[model samples]
Target: MTTRTFTNRLTRALRERALSLVDTGRPEGLVFLGAAAGTEIAKATGFGPLEKVCKPVIAPSALVVALRDGELGAVDTALLSATGAAYTVGDVILMLGGGHASRSVARLASGAAAFGVGHVALGALMLRSGIRPKALQMSFHGAVAGTVGGMLLREDRGNWPLATYGGMLAALSALATSVDHGRAPSASVLAVGGPVFLLSDGLILARRKVAGGSLAARALDVGVIDTYATATLLLLTGTAAAARSARGR
Candidate 1:
């Protein structure tokens, strides 16, 4: 081959590699961006007292997921944005010290409620997009199972109200996913990510039931949180890419 032709082929190959890297790295980069943004917001709002740790830990990945969903136009951008905002606010509330147990429960409940609203909105969007009714029904069943498991496994019986609220929210999120999965551009990602998200939350609840210092609790905590973050990143980014591909077709 001519030297000039060889050089041209090499350049094209390099360009393709560069594009691939950028595409793969964008989601992770966005996660870091969201985390940094959430940390700054927490500090500025005096919500950093506890969330300086927790918010930075979770919000980034979650926000990245929401942003990816928005970018793909697979879900309602406004609703996804609102969900992130609400969760951030709720985290701040939960982290706030100097509150009675009841007060803390109330704050947590409020956060869960906000999350439920987001889930309901997501479900509505899915339905509007023509998701099948069977998907919705299956989601409802999964939600019911989640609620029952949460209620039964709650550590503090006195916090039943909070547990109930959380269970309800989980159900709503599942319901939303059911609808979303029906028309999702990437059903496989949704299938895996959705269950992992639920499992993560379930583990979080399970931690409350288990002894704080126990190895089981610690394992559950780490496993769930990490899985949740990773799953969100995968699900959102995968779905977004798939949606874009479908649109192109």
Candidate 2:
């Protein structure tokens, strides 16, 4: 082969390799690896149920593999939400195991950060779909304000009402955004998952406020956890399917 042709092929190969590296280093991989490492550390220390950490992390990692050949699209939001969920669940696990208060705070903060980012991701999706960007932006603004106000109230007065309502509204807004845009069917999956998540989270918050330990609270807790897990699974898998299908088109 001619030297120029050889050089061209070599450059193309290198470019592909770089792209592969970039894909592997995305949020899904980073989150999975970080969680895996943390779980290992926690196990070594005899801290908690490491299996609980593994289950949720597996879905995102699998999604990264499934969508490796295409653009991630709004799946980025799903991955992030999954990561947040991992932290939230981990916080519960830590608390149940009587872990440190500081650690619990850190986990809760991670979940909060995820909630904030999910709104921005939804806005970006709306823009891409050529939907009502202005309306979506307004929704995003309201969501952010609600989140901030709710966090402040929780911190200052230990009130959870605002936070619960804010979360429910954000979830509904996400559903509406996904449903309004006809760009992809994966979004439809998101639409369904949103309300399921909202319902589960709302029930969990209600149980918390009820000063539980009753049989009803215990049953509700079990249902919420299962429902939330189902929602997360739906989101992660839907995102992967969306990315793959989007690329196919």
Top candidate on lDDT is 1
Per-model TM-score on C-alpha atoms? 0.58, 0.48
Clashes of each: 0, 0
In model 2, what are the clashing residue pairs, if there are any? none
Query: Clashing pairs in model 1?
Result: none
Candidate 1 TM-score to native:
0.58
lDDT of 2 by residue, 15-62 (tens): 543343336456665554455455444533444566356534643553
Model 2 CA RMSD to the hidden true structure, in angstroms: 13.5
lDDT to native, each model: 0.49, 0.47
Ten-residue stretch with the least lDDT total in model 1: 94-103
Query: Which ten-residue region of model 2 has the weakest summed lDDT?
Result: 97-106
